[model samples]
Target: MSEPQTEQGKSAMSEIQIPEMTGKVLACVDDSVYAEAVCDYAAWTAGRMNTQLSLLHVLDKNEGTTAQNLSGSLGLGAQENLMQELAELDQQRSKLEMEKGKLMLQAAMLRVEEKGIVNAESRQRHGELVDTLIELEPETRILVVGKRGADTESAHGHIGSHLESIIRALHKPILIAQQSFAPPKQIMIAYDGSATMRKGIHIAAASPFGRGIPHHVVMVGADTDVARAQLQEATDVMTKAGFEVTGAIIPGDADIALAEYQERENIDLMVMGAYGHSRIRQLILGSTTTAMIKRTKISLLVLR
Candidate 1:
């Protein structure tokens, strides 16, 4: 009888364990201003999920590939000899670059650990950023990146170039970091009643991610009866799950209304669906997901 009771306790413990999220949250870090925020959010997520964290920095050589142009003039044989020597010098330079990458990883790890994320790890590699993410996809539960990366210019009038591609590629949620870190107390949802947006709501309410945190579901429209009905229906779902819920219809366009609501209500984090339209379609019609992300400075928890 004692053995059976002991077994029942173990079974109950197993039953209560977190079901989703198979791996660590991998945050792609670079020297850009966004990297620190990425680390901060990664630590927060890892703490929330009771999971591990991994920080990765890719050299991304393809973006700025260039060949050496040796300056000094020399006789033909001497030039060939110098080229060989330069080849050796290039090898040394590559080694140094790898060392620098390691140093960056070490520093990022310290930042995370200092933030109380004890299970954090770091990786340094040389490859296309997208390719590196694809290779590491199997071991990743979530992906985190900056809205604007180091090459922020190329992404003018849009989300980060790498960010757009990564969202399109990954099946997991992506957290877009802002300039600084603040542990979010209130999460505002850009609910459109789409399957993906609903999934984001369910994840926040059911999973360990936002337990006890307040939620506000904001739908953008002209404030008609139909809009209020839709907002109430979604709010009911979250409320039934025991999340403190606030449902409202904000008047304006999607991007503008969301920005105003977040500002007015002091929303700490924004959650919404992503990439619902085709690239060609967005090019002609404009993407609300991209536009909204670009407008806000707070962290966004984007769902697919």
Candidate 2:
């Protein structure tokens, strides 16, 4: 973990008036296969909103500290030599990682620029991923991140370890990119009439993010009259906002129903309120937000 930023440092960061930091669509990229998708989705969003795009790559501190506590059972002089050699090796590895990050960022920049995003910029930082994103939260309008990282590529049905932490740490809207990108022709808003979901609906209605796209307001539960009424209320908000809206009250588990509806409707993006329950509660009884994130194949736009 990195040290917390000092008040003075925070103030300095606030004062640094970079034009790109204001309302920029920030995308976090790594060497994972989803990095290209993240860049592409971010480029599409930035283009739609007419905002600047920024790419961020965070180098985890633990990734560079593999030499610690490895000098076991060696003669004192030999141990010292080995420790020195390991230190040099660590330095070389850190340098290589830094160079690799630069190349990745360069490639991402070129990719977005090719998509007609000329104002795109990139940054490389050192620290944990969630911490880095929290520090940059002030500058971010919409944050784009991959569902899984390179470390978790083979682990099917598991989201990146940093994903939940990022959701918990930042208040900004996050877009979790899948393995591919396509412009969203239709979007589904997972609504359950909770305060958080209501806020999400309001944000979606007020913003131009998905203004002209067709919308599906889906609720998972028995198709009771009350459920229909709630779904209608939610869809009405979007309909009044000039969106072509369709409301559905499906049956079954929340995550399963939403995922099924999304696929059946060919929804390109699913927007929902993220983690409405407490962390401890979610730990005891699994989170639908996390489950949906893992289950769905399409990208998600999650609001806090």
RMSD of each: 9.6, 8.8
What number of clashing residue pairs does each candidate have, in the order they appear? 0, 0
TM-score of 2: 0.91
- Local error of candidate 2 at 202, Å? 1.5
Question: How well does candidate 2 match the true structure, expressed as C-alpha RMSD?
Answer: 8.8
Question: Which candidate number maximizes lDDT?
Answer: 2
Candidate 2 ranges beyond 4 A from true positions:
1-22, 70-72
Compared with the true structure, the alpha-carbon lDDT of candidate 2 equals 0.84
Using all chains and alpha carbons, the TM-scores for the candidates as numbered come to 0.85, 0.91
Local distance difference test, per candidate? 0.79, 0.84
Q: Per-residue lDDT tens digits of candidate 2, residues 1-304?
A: 0122344533342233322224889999899999999999999999988899999999988776668665568888988888999899989899999999999999999999999999888999998888889888998999999999999967779999889899989988899999999899999998877666666776787777897999998888777665666666678778888999998877788888888888888999999888887789889988999999999999999988
* Model 1 TM: 0.85
